[model samples]
Target: MIDVAELRIGTSGWRYPPWRGDFYPRGLVQRRELEYLSSRMNSAEINGSFYSLQRPERYRAWVEQTPDDFVFAVKGGRFITHLKQLRDVETPLANFFASGVLALGRKLGPILWQLPPRLAFDAERVEAFFKLLPRTSHAAAELAKRHDDKLKAEPHTDPSPRRKLRHAVEVRHPSFAEPESLDLFRKHGIALVVADTAGKFPYIDEMTSEEFAYVRLHGDEELYVSGYSDKALEKWARKIKGWGRDTYVYFDNDVKVEAPKNAIALAELLA
Candidate 1:
């Protein structure tokens, strides 16, 4: 039998107000929402980290909120992907690591680096950024040591090393559909994100990394609005099973509070 233990099903972000009276229990306190979500899902994407560097205490709190088996996939900062465009971002990357991501400890899963829709595929630029990615927590800490003054105030640079870190690149531009992009990601041992974005972006499904596969389900008929039907969920489950590697899937169709529902339903199918 193919081992499904490597599969993790979850939602991109969990703090939606629409989910309050519906998915999340009506009386459940706001602080315990994560605790509630963790009880149902095995994983979640820490998307707030993408907007800005998070504090160490926040990551530590997240560790406490979730179950021991639950994993959190941290999103790479937009400052590195969008603003910096992955150029000369050594310090920015270091600062990101230093800002408390390591505090997640054993619960930390893959790091997702999503490129903007406007950023086309540039082999040299992409490869250069991939070279800077640390494959392990220890290496991340070593890189963290190079962080600038921005993180000097109580930066969580050192935490005992935990599991091997994995990276997944989510490219939006159509230029990334080429085989060369896959080859570059494969060369760096980075998983190419299989994104379902309702035709707004390139939806690539090739498994570039043998280590694992990362998938993001934005929506079905509408971007971040529509929900996946039963057939869609079943198809995804079968595809994940056939991947033959650890796979992480996060539902991003949260505008209608369908992400968690879809994630839970998909997990049942896989189960």
Candidate 2:
């Protein structure tokens, strides 16, 4: 069995400006934000990687700054999920794999692939994408080797292959609520994101993987602005404990700068 200690609770990102006054100290410098934030949470979702590729030095610096046990759940780029729509994305996938993510090595947790609201469930397309995913860092390195010329220069091409690579898929379409979707996820060893999107997206609470689980708490009442109430945190704690699986929960309700506070509250409840 996989180590259950991999379970973690954290917020999506730490670079939000609003969090400086509320979660971060008033006089803290911007450069030291990650270090301070890591001390408070065992894990954090790297949302910036979703928008663009990250450099090796950045990953190395993050590793040096955070505690030895800290892990980052890197978000997959939208170029594959949003723009390319997961089709004909071999090169894009290669670019992502080559984008210094492996530098996180053991500090890396799950890679989150969030599909847009417009993309509905298609078993063929989904299966194709899943097959392309690398099951291990070694595999990712092999995939990265095929990266186009754009990333050839100064690419962090080394493979760590520390442990098995895990992935979680977050879908917004209502069509994904079906049993077939769950079956597909289970077949590919991918976790279905248990998301709370203020009733805006389809909320599916099934455990597709016994090895691990992934959850994104967008908000309790409002999508990105509202905080999870104490009662809500307590309920989530109970459910999470009941799962008895290595779980990763990231609070995405950061518009009001309540994500870190709510995430800490939930972690405390579990404690």
The RMSD of every model to the true structure, in order and in angstroms, is 1.2, 1.9
What does the lDDT read for residue 9 in candidate 1?
A: 89
Candidate 2's residue-wise lDDT over 23-55, tens digit each?
999999999999998999899999988998877
Q: Please tell me which predicted candidate would have the highest TM-score against the true structure.
A: 1
Q: 13-131, model 1: which lDDT tens digit per residue?
A: 89999999999988999999999999998999999999998899999999999989999999999999999999999999999999999988888899999999999999999999999
lDDT of 2: 0.90
**TM-score for each of the candidates:** 0.97, 0.97
TM-score of 2: 0.97
Model 1 poorest 10 in a row by lDDT:
152-161
The residue-level lDDT of candidate 2 at 103 comes to: 88
Give the Å shift of residue 136 in candidate 2.
0.6
